[model samples]
Target chain A: MDTTWSAIFTEMGWGMVTMVLNLLKVLIPLMVGIELLLHYKVVERIAPRLGWLCRLLGVGPKTIIPLLVGLLLGVTYGAGAIAEINRRTPLSKRDMALLGFFLFGCHGIIETTYLFWVAGASALFVSVLRLLIAVLVTAAAARFFRLAETRKE
Target chain B: MNAFTKVIVDGILRGLKTALMLLRVMIPVYLCVTVLKHTAFFGVLAGAAGPAMRIFGLPGDAVVPVVTGIFTDEYGIVAAMSGFAFDKAAITTIAMITLCFHSIPVETLVTRQIGMPAWKMTVYRLALAIATGVFTGWLAGWCF
Candidate 1:
């Protein structure tokens, strides 16, 4: 019994270390890159050009911030940005719903790409697949269900 | 300490702190996954998920997150994926579909916040995810 317990403990400990190290290797660099991009206002400049695309999915310009952040920082960071935006802007229920849907798949692009690449998959395929899915799912939700209707004024 | 040196020191310390915090969270997550795998809980989950998982050409284990992803998010699915030894194409396809539509809890909550029915959103997202997974997987298999 003791031996079994020790074996389990060891496996768990090793797995924990491996997971943590892997996550850090990806996260730290991505965070720094995102910070630099934001500092340069590069994302902001690019947001407008993507405006037509965003509109097709029924989200306003302001929604781009969280999407960009989420795409770089992962879900928690995206949620944090959305919460902050909600606090500051009083986004309607519709917008928040849309934001939530958008974030469902959001993760740092380079980070996820790298992770997938390391896992022996195609990074470009993963990145493009994620983006396409988010757009299609969000659009379908908005159109077929009219989920935006319940937005509180 | 000179000003430039002090700034660099501060930045390094901040990075270290962040790294430590991430370690704290990741440790528990890894343990949970490992334990789930060893205890055969994952197998049971896979078995239960057999029906839904079939659509994605995944074993029953694939169902746990495909179903859970409906409630939680893609992270849960990704976490689940960490336990498997899937081939590159399979992994890409799985990740693609999961990323496309996973997270039942968040989705349900958001839809409810907007006054949409939670049940409806749940069904729709699951169906969409399954459809996308099937199409993508088939396409990937054909190409590869």
Candidate 2:
């Protein structure tokens, strides 16, 4: 215990501060860019292409920006987009639950890429596996949410 | 506000709010992971978690990355993973796990605001991460 405490002070203390700084370096800029995109309502233009997939995912057009943002960027950014949707056009509980499942297995493209690069991980394996899991879980969630909704009705 | 002005101001305010909210979770978790690494508990954890990680073809120390990735971000996991000589297959599996489950603290907060249960999102991500890790681990074993 004494050695651990001393080690924390002498070594891990500096490591903690540096790691947090490293996180801010990546996250802050991403958040700011996402906020600006939201302010400009980029989703309005970008989401049209998501039409075909929307029905399949059980999410409406409103969920596109958030879902894509989370899939392509970070979940925090996606959450911001989803919050915007709730403020404007609320999603059904089923859709919201469905989205939770999709974002679970897939979020943050760059983070995944960086992990692959730094950790000697294979890009293809991670990408394919995550996409597979995301689609499967999302499909199951949609089915379950739909069944629950029907029962409620 | 003019269109140009609105974009800048809204971004600044919204970004600050989002960053602060994220920091609330990120900072504490970062500190906890960092401090834990300095303690003996990390080794004990690695010992216990080794078997589960072996299911993904990873060594026991890989637990640090898995735990860090779940709670924090890529950097934490990267920092945790840097020293080890993890093979290509183990790295791939770990990457999938981190991509799926990293930043649970902030992401769950976001989900709750979007009208889902935070715990549900966390559970969903974790389950999927595990599934994918297993899948990739198997793939790695088969291919190489």
Candidate 3:
């Protein structure tokens, strides 16, 4: 290893500049888009309408709130919302687990996907594959737990 | 709505804050990884881990980001792997896996609070992340 530490740092400094610039380009627009979506209450309106998705995830209608929140805002916020909801009406362990699994596979879709895309992954691949995997795992678990048939009554 | 302008401003602020947060961690990690790549230790470690990573169509050095991602988050992974060269397939695999399971300690608390056991969620996520990595590796090879 003939390369000195300072030399590596100098190289890394240049690399960082380029990387940060590329990241910011997409990130700024993405954050703006997210803010617009939130400001317009897109998730709020769209979440409740995903009853079929809720059914597919093997949870009741209310579970959609945390699922959507987690998908849009990331797991912490989504889980925070779930904690709030669970306090008012205790959710079943199965419901919580299903939500956890699904969100684990695909959360913070907009930012995460775009960030990875900037890092060289395909945006569509990251977003679609994660969502697909999340759905598959959650739906399978829901079936195994016999909760998928819990449609809106 | 008049508030639309405020929303855009908020977005820009939020984006700056997030970029700063990521840079705080990423810059140091990137520098460290870059230095480590020149070290004999990293070479040995990479050699040992190479086959395991090869299963996912990644080089051994790729483990740095994957493991960093487990302890930290996507930012850490990005920083850790900054110096390495990977094709799109490998990057996609890493992204898919890390996205499935990152920031375990903090997120595990969220899961616990939400009524799921921390250990269970952790295990599920790790398993799913690996599964996703393998699947993405295969898919990317065929597609990308």
Candidate 4:
């Protein structure tokens, strides 16, 4: 309410429209490519190599590319691809939560570098520490879930 | 439709639907933030959130980047910190928390798209960010 009519229209109207359009431009292709990947069986091939690692994290092998891609491409562009994987795969609730842990902490190498520069923080320290924490937390979660499973059994 | 054509159309439709779902969260929150930036509400918020910030050893003003980063992206925190002279400890502290938790509204929706509950995901990020920040802050305060 404190914002002037002009500010609201400019920031909310055209601004939001542009953001939505830009997001779609990246997301649509990623989503479509995910479908294409399924058709091509790309995920099936790569997923096998990630077997033990994925199990250690308690996530589906299908989550590997999205987690890796999220690290490299950043979460914004990777979100559609990740959501596509979740839709196609029968990942468990704990696996989804673990994926959330992996992606949220260590996403986007470039974004991290840029913010590191702006914040004048150490890149090695920030990125390495984050990756370490992600692995530890996800491993801990996986261990917790496995304990819960054993208890149920 | 052919199999290939079906894939294309279905993917496009699914993508569009996902984008729309995310936009529902982004648009209103973005507008609200734009409005808040122009009001005194932000200052009051910074003050209200300041005590919680000491665990990370950052000053009250660092709250700006933390909140901005939560709602937006790493770039948002970068932009907020551009004007400040926070030392390396504070900078690293802020970076850890924001790195874990940035882009909350939109990312929360995307996480929800993957079937994680939004509130739980948000809480996970926030709690982890703070715990990490506090630990790192304590470590940094000792080292530097």
Best model per lDDT: 3
Candidate 1 - CAPRI tier?
acceptable
Candidate 3 per-residue lDDT, tens place, A69-129, comes to 8897777668777988989998887788888888888998877887788888988888887
lDDT for residue B59 in candidate 4, whole number 0-100? 82
Residues A17-131 of candidate 2 have per-residue lDDT tens digits of 6545554555555556655666667756687887877877777777777888888766767787788878987887777877778877777765556446545777766666567
Per-residue C-alpha lDDT of model 4 across residues A1-153, encoded as one tens digit per residue: 545877656755765665666557645775687678667766456656877878777777667877766765578656766677767776667767787888776777654654474347867668778888888898898898889989999
Residue pairs clashing, model 1: B46-B60, B46-B61, B69-B103, B70-B103, B70-B104, B71-B104, B71-B105, B72-B103
In the range B1-144, model 3's lDDT, one tens digit per residue, is 579889999888888887887788888878878878888999899899999898888889888888888888777887776788888988888898888888988888767766788898899888888888887888888998
Answer with 2 or 3, whichever has the higher TM-score.
3
Candidate 3 interface RMSD, angstroms, 1 decimal:
1.4
Candidate 3 all-Cα RMSD: 3.0
Instruction: Mark the regions of model 1 whose C-alpha exceeds 4 Å error after superposition.
Output: A1-14, A80-101, A105-108, A137-153, B1-19, B39-45, B64-79, B100-127
Report the TM-score of candidate 1, chain A only: 0.71
- In order of appearance, the predictions have TM-scores of 0.69, 0.71, 0.92, 0.67
What DockQ does each prediction reach against the true complex?
A: 0.29, 0.41, 0.73, 0.39
lDDT tens digits, residue span A115-142, model 1: 6666555676778766777777777766
Q: Rank the candidates by lDDT, best first.
A: 3, 4, 2, 1
Tell me model 4's lDDT, rounded to 2 decimals: 0.73
Question: How should the candidates be ordered by DockQ, best one leading?
Answer: 3, 2, 4, 1
User: How does the DockQ of candidate 4 come out?
Assistant: 0.39
Clashing pairs in 2: none
Across all candidates, the chain A TM-score values are 0.71, 0.67, 0.84, 0.63
